[model samples]
Target: MVFSWRKRKPRNGDKKVHNMELEIPRHFICPIALDLMKDPVTLSSGITYDRESIEKWLEDGNFTCPVTNQVLRSFDQIPNHSLRKMIQDWCVENRSHGIERIPTPRIPVSSAEVSEILFSITDSRRRLDRCGCLDSVHKIKKWGLESERNRRCVVANGAAGVIAAAFDAFAGDSFEKNAHAHLLEEMLCVMYWMFPLAQEAQIYLGSQASLRCMVWFLKSKDISVKQNSITVLKELLCCDQQYGEHLAAIDGVNRILFKFIKNPISPSITKASLMVIFHTVSSSNEKTKAEFVEMGLVSLLLESIIESEKSYCERALGVIDKLLETKQGREFATDNALSMPVLVKKILRISELATEYSVSAIWKLSKYEERVLMEALQVGAFQKLLLLIQVGCSDETKEKATELLKLLNPYRPGLECIDSLDFKDIKRSF
Candidate 1:
């Protein structure tokens, strides 16, 4: 039963034998690929498949047999060398039938190779060995995606330090100017795959040079690089509170982050940038509020709330409320043309946190910028406030809304004090 896999037309003058068809044996076909087994390997479930197919399946977080639908005892893929040889022999014997012999696959990277690359990366004298180190790092990153074992090998061999060095070398005079930008983007790609790294790795990657490189990537023409950089920053900066000011002082950091709020490539990217901003403003003071105002963060956040998801709007509103704690933040929100309308719209519209922050922002504006009170009322905010009172809210939101309503129209004849309202029977009309 010789297996056949290809075809050629019979000669015109040949006898009926010339048109005879060659048939393929069913056993030679891989169950997963439905084709002749090239590099055949058997799983614990005793089913054979092409090695690449089964390895990919296991690495994708699957723990069961694709064929038997049973829980796999182990993920080990033992090479079916005898079956592969038989398939190869069949191809050889059927050469006249147009079957092509399959070539052997390359062996995947081993822990030894990864360790060698790790040593090459950290050796101070090897700074001039940039291309080779980068190629090695790139290969490890490729192999890391192939299996859980390879990922562990790559990380155990100090992948974090190598990536950090790669970025640092990019900033220094290691690569030529033309190729420098190219490698910087590549380094970021590697970082993207290695997210949520070990705490020690995060500290090593938080070097001043690495920090600057990541901030620079926020403006990258490649959206992927920008997103990866922001994610990396969030992972590193959020882990340690002491690095907050260091991130804040990076040139163009605030401006670039604010820009992402208005021109985000995706919700995830915007969320990442917002998280970085939140970390940067953790312990911020009046000077920090003024800096954000100068960078137009207030307007960007106000605009963000209009179309962002619930979580995004909540974060933006929370940041805005924090900014309002300072005089500069209040003035910026009051003066921006769309800020009042956007903030007022968020009241009783989005999530509870958004409504809380929106009411707080309005309270601050009414308290400090007395001139903007009527504008808040004109945007239907008074109705939302009445709704807040009618339906009820958190004790704090209820108190703040009560204060704001008094400031808006002090002498309303029928208005009830927040303390006297019974929340259980309250109705929300609007």
Candidate 2:
């Protein structure tokens, strides 16, 4: 890796240099490149780095100082003139040792430049220039990745709306099959990078058309698009609870959600999709619950309960608890093969919250349906309930278990109650 810059004989009055090797000063080396820094800049974390190396790091979507592993409070990188001078001096001294002096690096784009890009993209009168503006938007997205300040600038300049418009434009009339699908994905990626977006901006971009476009993104073959689409929708849903109903009403929401459940692309995607469903159902009426039942959510929950990890199981159980508020949900749970066993298996096994949810589901079923009661008895639910009472459980869990036991006690074998019309009057005579 070493290169000879020059070869010269020893000069007069110079001490004989025994070491022929050239070694870079430790302070001059960039943490990223492990070479002499060309343009040294100090971050808010009190770490100094090469401007080009740090800029590239930020562009790659990293938000922390690489050397110290500290989350940077400010994205600004101030030029370290002292360090730069020292490095330059070291380079000059080593010139005879074949060391090359580093050149200055380019400065990053300014917020004003990003602002101009966003304005052009949003200004429709310049129709011919929109494409070029979108290209600028892509550049701004790159800049945003470099630092939080740039990210805030992107949002402040209405990048959210611009990205939404890009989504709608490139989605085309046929939408999913649009030729500009890559542009659509790029827009989504930018939006995700600018996450925790302003509420007003989220509301602005949460238009009906935008909702539909995001739903379409869920069905995309591209996994990144799908992840970003769900993430954006989840964030938008957080902006306003009313949007949950609007999202649920959108076509293919249920189908796509079910698809995510049936064939998960990743744990994160599955969790987000489930959250959307949970949010939608939370704002909905009985009809929505029935629709969820018709979409086979019950079966999906049962499968998820058995196969998924603790967190997924907890979420599935929570959603099932909501769905079981309706007759259809109760029927689905009572009839499914894995429903009872999985419910019984998870009780007292995963987490306190999970145990509470499982007990609640079983309590709902056993209270109304005799068949479910018998099924519960056969599956050792009664024993588990008694055990739940004896062992430590939450107050709510103990109350539910006690109620379930009371309901089942009457149905216990040889414990049938007789008509007692005259018993009050007969008293001791009986």
Candidate 3:
């Protein structure tokens, strides 16, 4: 593909300079990518492709070579350092043609490297060197933060066990110090990156001491630390059912969660708090749900339903509906000043899920308390229920709406009650 052109006379450095405009050779390109290889490597089939392309091919569950179509026995790729050097040299020679030199790829971290880090943390903890242990934990956290490959390497080599053990051991009086709080943050944050924990790690982290460490952080004055604590708790519990029940068994977990939800540090914290409650509030009997009902969860839920957007509101309403399954919840709702008003206000006004929960809560109230049937009439529930049917909703919701209308039909006001409805405190959650 060379173009015929004139050759000028040799300059003073002609012997030192053999540079000329050259076309790219076919072999210099990756066969799979059909482009120049930035990180060329040789596959088991003796064919070459860019490292990223081959990794993607193997990750997609393909076992055969893309070019040779041969079954692959090993997926390891040896770096084609020789060919990479040739391409780099060619780019340097053709610098005047806008070719940039590609930098060498980094060496991937391995499980062996992470095992050494785990040893340092274990040794530091054994020697009672809190400062040294903190430093080792910081190193592991930094590496995990660098890349997903580094995180996998760290977690695969048992970083979770050592870090969680150290964190649990710090539950003594020293846990009160501000300095130790920072150490706790570093330790817990690393646990977050290693999701889908190994069975052994899950068992160790599910211990009472480990659970206490995170619950303490949930009460930290720092908003970020509070958020991190809740986030880690959610992930740790969500990983296994036994872990969730253990945390729920803690005496003050719900109280702290409800308070956090009431005066949330941020919307994410509020949402996470709701999720923790959602995951933990049930215990196969009515007493557990009753405890939450008596603990002001119902009031907080009504507030969330009014202040939050679609998803959070729907979640809040769902928790409320769950709470109503108990006699205590129904009595509390009928007693609370804002329960019926707030629940009725959300009907036909928010998301379909939210509307469903709201209608269902009111229906439950009407079914047991009997007084809610009139409370519904006062808040313009009858008109909203009728309009809901007209606009259409889930068949279940429509049936409930129909029955609710039937309950209030004799008392249906002669005039529209839209003006009397109050949505005065609706706040933006997103």
Number of the top lDDT candidate = 3
Cand. 1 Cα-lDDT: 0.73
Per-structure clash totals for the candidates:
0, 1, 0
lDDT of 1 by residue, 1-430 (tens): 3343434455575344443457767888877777788888888999998877887788799899889989999877788888888988888988767778886655556667887777766663256555765676677668866766567657666677666765665555533354566666666777676756666566655667667777877777888878888888877766775566777777777878877877768888988877777767765556766788777788878876788778888888877887888788887888888877788777766777788988988898888865677677666666678878777789999999998887888533343233232233444323
Residue 34 displacement (Å), model 2:
16
Native RMSD of candidate 2 (Å): 12.1
Residue 382 deviation, candidate 3, in Å? Answer: 6.4
Question: What is candidate 2's lDDT per residue for 229-321, written digit by digit as tens?
Answer: 998887777666678888878867878888898888998999888777777777777887788898899987887677667788778888898
RMSD of each: 8.3, 12.1, 7.9
Where is model 1 poorest over a 10-residue stretch in terms of lDDT? 415-424
- Descending-lDDT candidate ranking: 3, 2, 1
How many clashes (backbone atoms < 3 Å, residues ≥3 apart in a chain or on different chains) does model 2 have? 1
Per-residue error at 263 for model 2, in Å?
2.9
Q: lDDT values of the candidates?
A: 0.73, 0.75, 0.76
TM-score (C-alpha) between model 2 and the true structure: 0.67
TM per prediction: 0.64, 0.67, 0.71
Give RMSD (Å) of candidate 1 vs. truth: 8.3
For candidate 3, the TM-score is: 0.71
Give the runs in model 3 whose Cα sits over 4 Å from its true position: 1-36, 82-103, 115-136, 153-166, 169-182, 240-255, 284-297, 325-332, 335-338, 341-356, 375-430
